[model samples]
Target chain A: MTETVIQTRGLTKEFIRDEFHVVALDRVDIDIRKGEFVALMGPSGSGKSTLLHLIAAMDRPTDGEIRVLGQDLRGLSDREVSYWRNSHVGFIFQSFNLIPVLNAIENVELPLKLTTLTKKEQREHAATALKLVGLEERMRHLPRQLSGGQEQRVAIARAIVTDPDLILADEPTGNLDAASADEALNLLAKLNRDYGKTIVMVTHDPHAAGFATRVCHLEKGVLLESLQADGS
Target chain B: MMRISNFLPLVFKNSFRNRRRSILTVASLALSLCLLGLLMAMYEALFYGPDPTPAQAVRLVVRNKVSLAQPMPLSHEQKIRQVPGVEAVMLQQWFGGTYRDARDPNNFFARFAVQPQEVFSIFSEYSLPEAERQAFVRERTACVASRTLADKFGWKTGERITFVGDIFPVTVELKLAGIYDDPNQNEVLYFQWEYLRESLRPVFGGEMDMVSQFILKADSPESVPRISREVDEMFAVTPFQTKTESEQAFVLSFVSFLGNLKLFMLAIGGAVTFTILLVSANTLSMSVRERIREVGIMKTLGFTPGIILGTLLGEASLMSLTGGLIGCAFAWALCAMISSAPIPFAQLRGLALTPLITLICLSIAILIGLGSALLPALNASRRPILDSLGHSG
Candidate 1:
């Protein structure tokens, strides 16, 4: 039996803005098994990104519980959550959120600094991760020097450098051109298919969602449907 | 745990991301610290002389009880020498004069008529060759000039220099007997007391037996207060009552004539420090605000809040220290240049930065950095990762 990597039950999040309570997610339930590439699709006001944030433990749920890798996230302190997230989850953002001051190799090595790896081992792992993303020649290039596709690849290298169990991407290809978007999607597909790394992505584009094995739809902070992948 | 070395490059790069703003902030801090160091040196020089010596603690000066302008009778020197703990006594009279030079008519230097034999013994710090000391004693109309004074006026040994007296009603000529070197004394000329008294005797009969002040050396530092008290009490009822104080106190009283200069300097220094603190803090705050997204990226990469705070504080401290050192160096150079110039103020000599002053300047720089960055660092550290990541640019 494939083990469930992420489990959410009755999870809810509400944000208070200017004394007005607006619910972002309402009692959402989600389960993602090991090695499953799940795409969360929703419109502008949907809770797809909010759900991804909760699963990555970047935020706390207002009510109910979330378990990632079979450990209850609510029981952990803020510091423990941070350590657990570093070891268990890798996040990719729409803007390719690589630190501008650092080169590709240094950006990749950032996450591994939290691990017990020696400096040499960190360098070796970072180099290997960059090479995996087809950016071995561009390891010394800063983010501004790289193209949009190359920047996303470097972000991918940074995400996987720690060998995390799950990768969470929020609108990963939203800022890319069509060709670069296709290239970034192909890399995500390869990462999930070959390395068996579980992925949860939030996107509005059906072409981006076509790469995932399963698609979950959300509307008005409610999960409406789960659809099987139509082979791309 | 992240190694500090790993964070240093990022911290340094981030500090100068806004190069213009950072450069301006550093320049402002450096200039302020330079001014602060110079003011402190000036205050020190005014109250303590250029370079106070250990022997100054054991010496006392006796003057008129009413004011320094009034002269004391030269006969009181014998009575002061008789006081207990008095090791040596010398009579000194001020001679206000200017050399008869056409190029510089008002170039005035300190001229005093002191007892030739007792001057060297009383001011042990002054060093002169044996031959010159003998020459100064052998010739009744001979005078000794400081090396600085000799260089300024281009006087040589055996040369006769004439001074047109401004205070006394006599034109005096004397052979330059010797040039002496002392770190604390600057641009002074000393001649025999008898020459001045004899020259003025015919003009003001009997009244010429007055001296400006008397310098007494005690046998030990422990007996200075006792000797001062005994000297003052002995002349309490006399027409020319005396006020006795240590050499340091006498210099301090002279500086007191400037009226609260130390407090004024402290106020200016404080204002400068506070102004720089606000400027540096504002700069750091703006830097943090501009890098909100970058901070969030680091957070997502597993950097703890404490780590972020330390990185920001480290950047601030490094910037401040750099500015402070440059300012101190500039101030030290300025002092060296001033000391070599032909300045009439004796207090401006040896105004260079001391080790204590350097340390203080550096410490203030660090404090400015730390104090300025504290609130901004805390705000950056406490900011939620989601909020930071959500912030645009």
Candidate 2:
């Protein structure tokens, strides 16, 4: 066991839309040791995404403690949370979500900008990350010029360029074709197996969730089941 | 080093991507500079204009008490000399003239009758040799022509020029003597004052010694106002009154009649400055709108909002500064071309876009740039990460 990189206790998330209060997550306690591959599976609006956002420090939890590398996110300011997110966490979203203006290399180099690393060092890291994702040769191509899968690879490169310990992936293959989604899932699997990075991924697609070592099913703001032996 | 190096190409490409808009903006700045330059140049020409000053040292003009139109007694020439400021005395009448060749007379200009011997003494800036100046005094029919007037008639030194005098009700022909120009003086013309007096033999029974006006002088500008006041007081009790002022004040006083055109010029300058501000702001706003996604990405990457805002404002200032420099260069060229002109408000034209003026213009560009960029940058910087992250466009 490397360590317990992230720990959460009694987490709850509420969504209010048009004066309607909807409980997205209810008093859910989860613990995973470092180097864990945990998939959060649920249908749309099943609090999977909300739980991901809260744990990633992208949103403040209404109640309970969520800690990344032992830093409690409860009272952290926006800037503080942003700093923590930039340095400690990497994200792979369902959408490719790349800046159109920047090329693949520049997009990869984006998160590295937050580090105090030198420009040359940042570029080297970004290039290495793209190479790891097997897209080094496509560095200079803009998002428009790249395919959907390639853009997602670039996004993954950007997320990992900072070498963050925890990679939070939310429906990383939601926009990809089956072939491309297979490629993305394989990459994530390889990242978890080889690099020993802890990953907490949320997905509606069972095939996408198949890549994780364990899958947690959530229903109506409650954890329904935890299925282990899921290395599909 | 790469960060800085990369910024240049990126900024340059983006700034000029809308090529037509950028060029039109540059040209607009240039046109403003041109207009400003021409106005300043013409003003300089009319005031300390490039045309040489007329006889200032050796000769002086004696005028009546009340004004320029009145005549002064010829005997007063000796009395004027007795005054400490007066070195020599000459007589001149404004010879309002059309042209002898009215069929197609060239540009309109005026000529004056001058006391030749003392003309160069009183108008020391005039560059006539003492010999020619003396000859003009001795010869009753000799006249000194300005270059523009001489150029019109194809006249040369020692050649004769003729004019149909409107004031005297007769035709006047005078011998041309040594072309002249005075570096320190302004617009003027001169012929022998005695020639006019002698030429008037039929009208005043050779009593043309009664001079139309007199030119006064002092050793320095410091003495001018005092001597002017004293001279006026000397004729205070006489039937004729006197008015005296420095030549510059005399010339500038005429500017008042156009009814605060200087203020109008100031208003025009303000309007130009205001327009540049608006232009810069609009450009910045549009640029910000285009870069929303890029900004969002930057924020997610850990770039602080301050950095994003600074970068955008810096870009705006950079563009405006470049445009301002081109404008200043255009203004410099225009100023050089019209440094010498014959317009009435010469002081107001040929205005030098001095280093300070250039800085001011560029600074205005920068201020406008930053001012316009502030809001857009703020909007972009504070934009929620989610909105931009989710932005389809």
Candidate 3:
């Protein structure tokens, strides 16, 4: 039962643009168990990312309820949401968005900066995270100095630096080549298996999606399929 | 907070990022401060009170029947001294001379020839110790000078000082017997009255009787106006009409000219403050624009509206204080250099470091810094986070 780490009841997200309403999510209802690794699959216009954003508390749903890790997110202030994000949730963006000025260790240390963590501890954590991504030797390298896969690995290192319970990755491999995608996915899979982290990913590639234990699809703004994992 | 300590250096780095603009701003501030300080020092020089008027019981100035430029007779001193409140009478005459160094002329104050014994008594800025006074009166070749004139020629006690005489036409060589300073009366660089009297006994050219006004002292303040009236009445029958007034009133008349100069300086000070305000505001605006996204990031990172606003303003104030300090230091340094230069009016004393002046000047800088920062900082605070995250657009 794992206490259902995420539960949404008839959740919806709608954006109003120039007198027309764009429904980005429609009547989404799901229960994702604790420690589960799930993939949300759809093309660009699908509701995958919107659902991911709602569950991550990055934005509020237009209607209905979302309970993430047993806490209803609608009542959280932006500050509380930021606090929750820093302490409880992790995000890996598709672009591997690393601040260009900060070196790999600093980028990994970004989330911890808002905490009362001592400087030495923050460095230790960032170094350990970078080492997990096998880029410890390159901790001092800037983002521009790193190859695309290394930068993506640095981004993953940043995501879990705070030891968040749930890792929400938006197209974690969308920008990487096949090898880098494999590496990013392997890292995510390792975080789930090794650290027992709850993982939810939004991606367009089925090959990338195949790495997850379950797959879900959306058509237009509607969730169309929820299927159990069948093959590698 | 780490933010505040780190934030100031970041603001300073903004100035360095665009060195040209920062230099222009600093230069303008320094120049304005320099000019303001110079004006204040000059005005102080001009209004220096009767610096130690002689304690002589009864002495008076006998000027014209009408105005100051109209000098009165040496004979008028004799008649004025005979009046009830008067004690002793003697004469001194002004010899307005340019310096021997014609390369920089107009370095003129006043030189007077006096009956040496009565000279120190009548005008009394001409003080020598009793022995030196006796020796000075005994020898026509001897003269005494104000401390300022002595220092000007690098002359010490017993050293001979000379000036190219303008009216007398002879290079007057005189001994500096002692240093002089007076908080009242006038500072007169003087030689014997016999020189002007004897020298003029031959020329006898123009107004033979007139001494450039006379210095008169009353037994008390109550008698000043009455003594003044009788002196004017005595000269009324003569050709030169006398306008007698208290010494204080005489010095006060020059205040009108100085007042206009003060008004002009105040206008410049106003402009200085206003210009710095615009410059600092522009600097703040540019700085805020560059960090618009960081503002958004800060907001999203849980910093409050007040935190953003306060940080912006604090940075601005710090900038102003730094600029103010530099400008003030520049003004002080310039004053020191000018004080040491060969300028008579410059040796005119004032503390180059006046707290009120620094406070007011730096106050302008801080005010300008804060005022300029306000709109831009407020604008940055109210901007939507979405717009900020998108930097270029």
TM-score of chain A of 2: 0.96
Error of 2 at A193 (Å): 2.3
Q: Write the per-residue lDDT of candidate 1 for residues B241-358, one digit (tens) a residue.
A: 9999998788677666667878888899889889998888888788888887777888887778888889889989989998999999988988888777766666777677888888
Q: Please provide, for model 3 over B14-121, each residue's C-alpha lDDT reduced to its tens digit, 9 standing for 90 to 100.
A: 444456765666666566656665555444445543242335323445556455555665677677777777655656577765556656733554677777776655
lDDT of 1 by residue, A1-232 (tens): 9999999998899999899998999988888999999999999989999999999888889998899999999998777877888898999999999888789999999888778788899899999999999999999999999999999999999999999999999999999999999988999999999999999999999999999999999998989888879633
What is the lDDT of every predicted structure here? 0.88, 0.72, 0.72
Ranking by DockQ: 1, 2, 3
What is the per-residue lDDT of model 2 for residues B1-393, given as tens digits with 9 covering 90 to 100? Answer: 125443443455456656787677666655665555444444444444333233322232345645566776766556555677654455556887656554553345557776677667666666776777777777777777656556655878878667887778767777787667644323456776666666788887756656666677666555666677777777788766656565555555556456675676667777776776677677668878877877766666666677677677777777777776777787777666544444434454435666666676667666766787899889988887666666654
Candidate number of the best TM-score = 1
Off by over 4 Å in 2: A10-29, A74-82, A93-95, A114-119, A216-232, B1-110, B145-155, B160-174, B184-188, B194-214, B228-243, B255-257, B340-350, B390-393
Highest DockQ model number: 1
Lowest summed lDDT across 10 adjacent residues in model 3 chain A is found at A93-102
What is each candidate's fraction of native interface contacts (fnat)? 0.46, 0.22, 0.07
CAPRI accuracy category, model 1: medium
